[model samples]
Target: MQLSWSQPCSSGMIQLLLVSNLLLWECVVSRPMCLDIGYKKLFLQELFDRATVIAQYTSNLTMQMSEEFDENFAKNLEYKARNSSTCHTASLTTLEINEQIQQTQSDELLKVMISISRVWYHPLEHLVCEVAARKGTCETMLSKIKELEEKNQELLEEMKGILVRVHPGAEENAYPAWMGLAEVRSDNEDTHHFALSNLLHCLRSDTDKIVTYLEVLKCQVIHNNNC
Candidate 1:
């Protein structure tokens, strides 16, 4: 079957295919198609494993970004505090501005971290469990996959905006860079965007293949039943 990104497999179609495959497998012990049952189970298990790995990788990357942001923000704060003039009034004003910057940076990092957990990590982890236990219908699993894909896309857009602001450029830095301190490199931002986009593409491809495979199985079952 041809997989078209333009035309995703509908939830109803997935449910129909899965139900057909299940019903056919139940009576296939004495039939020539018995081996297909084992193959289907193996294929699904493998897909689940791949998804689990991708989810774990994304989660780790997000956590790493969060920690790095926190450390850099702290260092920037210290640098500002130390460099401000010793005059009491000047120091007070500097402190207030530094505090506001810290708060803003903290809020942005927290937003990104929370979005990553809510959109990608939590749902995929739950999906791994469901697939392993064979507890949910294929349609349900596909729906979750679709949701993840959407969330991943949303995250990519958000990261791009953050990268544009934080990336070292000619303009005033959205994230203040400490002169002697190690800066958050532009490469790190690129890596994060590339990783997420790659994962999202892979997931969409895998989901399409699974749906196509199920469609093929359903057809074979119908043909055998007709015979």
Candidate 2:
């Protein structure tokens, strides 16, 4: 009579096989996709560079605005001093009002710059850690990108508000640096708002590209594993 093969009868052998399978699964899961990791690092670097440029540009703008206000205020004070005999009190009050307006405008510009810094720093920090550790999934990165885009949009709105205050019913020619030919027809646009809008558009475009790449990478990995 021929002998037939039989399944393992010992619980110990069954348990050992289960443990081996678990270890194998862990190995597969833990192995980082090197190519994807490299892509993420490059993407983050590009994002950081763009953010730095924007921050520096805004900081310079703030300085220029502050200096311009100071120059104008000093000139007005000199004029008032020369004409002090005519209406000293009236001139002083006018100077005070001008000073207050300048102070408010300067403060608004500083706030916008600060907001941009915050929006840039936090997400980049988190992304750096996630990319380094290879701990987060593509879905997590997508969530972060979306959150960043939303915050960036808010920043654009804040900049628009500041521009509106600084240049109420401002003609397109009044702040040509910020207003487009098409936007010039509207009396309510300025350079700061235009700059912010362009920045937000670029950020959203970059994020969209990252999201698409991530989706493709994830799908390819899944497909490869299935094969």
Candidate 3:
């Protein structure tokens, strides 16, 4: 006997399929759903609070370091401000993830965040590595940078987990050409000081952007429709 595509399933099969679908949807709607994931609390208050504390601590540390760089390393000398296109800072990392952009679909928002971390992570890594290699670098700042990098990774993973549930379709994101900081020659004292100083400024600016974007994302994620 030939079976047809139109053939109906047994009543038991239908019930099984229906229940499976319901459970799947529940997983999605509940967010961070299931025992496997970090629980999805409405408004993600705990997550936001965690992010806020981290942002404030990192930003303040960055600002302090920037000031320290200016005061100590920047001995009075005629040094031209070196703002190379390749060696620019991370201030604009959040330009794509602002409040205005939050009005877009949450899935898209999550994707944007994931993309930002991918693009922004390495540049910060390169910046920190460069600083760490130099003598007399502040151990505290280095520790903070390491902490910031860890947070970035954690945030990326968290977004990715949500995205899989929300929108499993992730296309390769295009990073801004300037997002990747290029290596520079620091042969001269003036050049080294200027380059290092510029890097600190860039990292500082980037930290501010990260903090701002995190707050926006935290509120957006937690409030959901209210956002």
Return the TM-score for each candidate structure. Answer: 0.24, 0.26, 0.59
lDDT by candidate, in order shown: 0.38, 0.37, 0.61
Best by TM-score: 3
**Per-residue lDDT of candidate 1, residues 17-47 (tens digit):** 9999998887775465667766755554443
Q: Candidate 1: what lDDT?
A: 0.38
CA lDDT for candidate 3: 0.61
- Window of ten residues with lowest summed lDDT in model 3: 84-93
Q: Report the Cα lDDT for candidate 2.
A: 0.37
Which rank order by TM-score, best down to worst? 3, 2, 1
The candidate with the higher TM-score, 2 or 3, is 3
Q: Which residue pairs clash within candidate 3?
A: 43-222, 90-206
- Top-lDDT candidate index: 3
The candidate with the higher lDDT, 1 or 3, is 3
User: Which stretches in model 1 have alpha-carbon errors above 4 Å?
Assistant: 1-31, 74-227
User: Which is the winner by TM-score between candidate 1 and candidate 3?
Assistant: 3
Task: Write candidate 3's Cα lDDT for 122-225 as tens digits.
Answer: 65677578667767778876776667677667756655665564456766355564433333335666666676666666666655765666666666666654
